[model samples]
Target chain A: MKNKSIELMKRYRFFAIMIVVTLAILVVKPDMGVRVYSLAFNSVFEMLGVLPPIFILIGLLDVWVKKETMVKYMGKDSGIIGVLLGFFLGSAAAGPLYGAFPVAGVFLNKGSRLANVFIIVGAWASMKIPLLLFEVAAMGWQFTLIRLVMDIFGVLVIAYSMEKILNDDDERQIYELARKMSQ
Target chain B: MIMTIIFYGLAVIGLVFSFVKSREKTKMALMKALKAFENILPQFLGIVLLIGVILSILSPQQISQLIGENSGWVGVVIATVIGSITLIPGFLAFPLAAALLENGAGYMQIGAFVSSLMMVGIVTMPVEVLYFGKKATLLRNGMGLVFSILVAMVIGGIMS
Candidate 1:
């Protein structure tokens, strides 16, 4: 029991330290500290609102989507279809970029091409469909359209470049890492 | 709002379908989801706190001042740096960007900020490194930073 508690503490060490820092800020700067509290509250609320469904979807994908099916669509020779699927899956996703990492890890674990996984990450980061609507509303269609076009190309270029730059050994290690993470 | 509803709607539909297919598998999926959520809880808490600190320190007025129209390429660099470091959600970030634009921040600077805010994540690097390893994480974020700058330049050229 004691060992388990210690391990849990070790896992949460970063969070513990941050709490201390936030408390110190509250003590030293009351006004800013109040702002921090409210902001943190809002962030937590947002996170809660977005994360549950995302994780549920991920869990469903993991359970229902067979490895062979994933591989068939997104694996080594899946090619442009894989790329398009990556983009579609990513754009359709809701929540922050961090949420995409676990999904990408699952993709890699299921034998997705490295470039395809990168495409998912890239699209999730910059090309989320829902966020695009928000961007259009706030930044106008001209700015939104221009950035969207550029991002489509940018995501593709970055995905392919990252795949090309990593050697075979690095690729093996990444796949190994993903396997560990998903498990 | 609509997005949130869509997400929940899809998840609920998926859960119902999965449950009808196999209660055991549905239970297993929920367990896996809980486990994954718990696994990342510590990092998520830390990120939330960090964002609180950063956002509190950098108000919209202050951000706009740093990246105003007259701030030039220097503003773009600052915006990129800030964007790379901070991890604001899209909902908050877009309105903030819009407000900054209204406050005389340049299109280029806003573009840099928005792009990097989405793509490059210095604050979330720890979480990223766990999944991607150190080298891949660094390379991905580095590429994202470069791409964000390119995005800014093009937006600046065309929009302004």
Candidate 2:
């Protein structure tokens, strides 16, 4: 029981510290504290709304997608098909960038090519289609279209370069981490 | 939003199909998801709270002043730095960028801010490091920061 409680504390240390900090702020500056809570709560509410289905999809992918299938579609030799799929998957998603990490873990666990996973993340970060529409509306079609074109190129460049920079050992370590996390 | 509807629709369809195919596998999938979410909950809470604190402190008026018209490359640098640190959702970010632009913030600086806001996340680095390790996280964000500058330059040249 004691050990379990200790483990829980370790897991929650950062959260606990932040809570205390928030409380201290509340004491010192009630207005600021109220703003903090409202903003934080809003975000938490939004996250709660979005994350469940994403996690479910991730879980399904982990359980259903065979390693061979993932490798064939997204592994090192999957080529342009893999890249397009990565881009599509990333662009189609709805959620924040952090939500992409666990899904990326599933991809890694399924033996996806490093570059493809990187593309997925890059797309998730900046190239999301729905967000692009929003961008276009706000910034004008010219700005949005140009940025979109450049960003596709940017995503590819970042993905491939990052893949090249990672040595075999580093790749292995990341793969291992993914494998452990999903299990 | 339409995106949320699409996500839920897809998830429901996928879940139904999985259930039909194999109840056991569906169960396993849900369990794995719950475990993954539980594992990250603590870090997620911390990150969100940090974002709230940062955003509350950096009010919209302050942002407009920092990146106002004629603020130039210095404003771009400041905007990019602010973007990198703050974790604004893309939906809110675009509208806010519009509001900033209307309030006299330069397009170049807004470009830098939007690009960095999407790509580079300093506050969420802890969650990223959990998945990609320390070195990769730093390298990716570093490269992202550089790329955001390029994006700003391109937008500036074209729009100006």
Residues A66-175, model 2: lDDT tens digits: 98999999998999999999999999888899998888999998989999999999999998999999998888898788778888998899888998998888888888
Give lDDT tens digits, candidate 1, residues A1-183: 999999899879988988999999999999999999899998888877778998888788889999999999999989889999999998988888998888888899888999999999999999999999999999999999998999999999999998999999889998998777666
Positional deviation of B21 in candidate 1, in angstroms? 1.0
Please state the interface RMSD for every predicted structure, separated by commas.
1.2, 1.0
The runs of at least 3 residues in candidate 1 whose Cα sits more than 4 Å from the true structure, single-residue gaps closed, are: A1-7
Clash count, one per candidate: 0, 0
> Where does candidate 1 chain A have its weakest 10-residue lDDT segment?
A174-183
lDDT of 2 at A128: 94
DockQ of each: 0.75, 0.78
TM-score of chain A of each: 0.92, 0.94
Report the C-alpha lDDT of model 1 over B1-160, residue by residue, as the tens digit. 6777888899999999999999999999998788778777888898889889998998888999999998998999999999998878898899999999999999999999999999999888777876788888899999999999999999999988
Docking class of 2: medium
Error of 1 at B65 (Å): 0.6
- Model 2: per-residue Cα lDDT at residue A67: 88
CA error at residue A98 for candidate 1, angstroms: 0.9
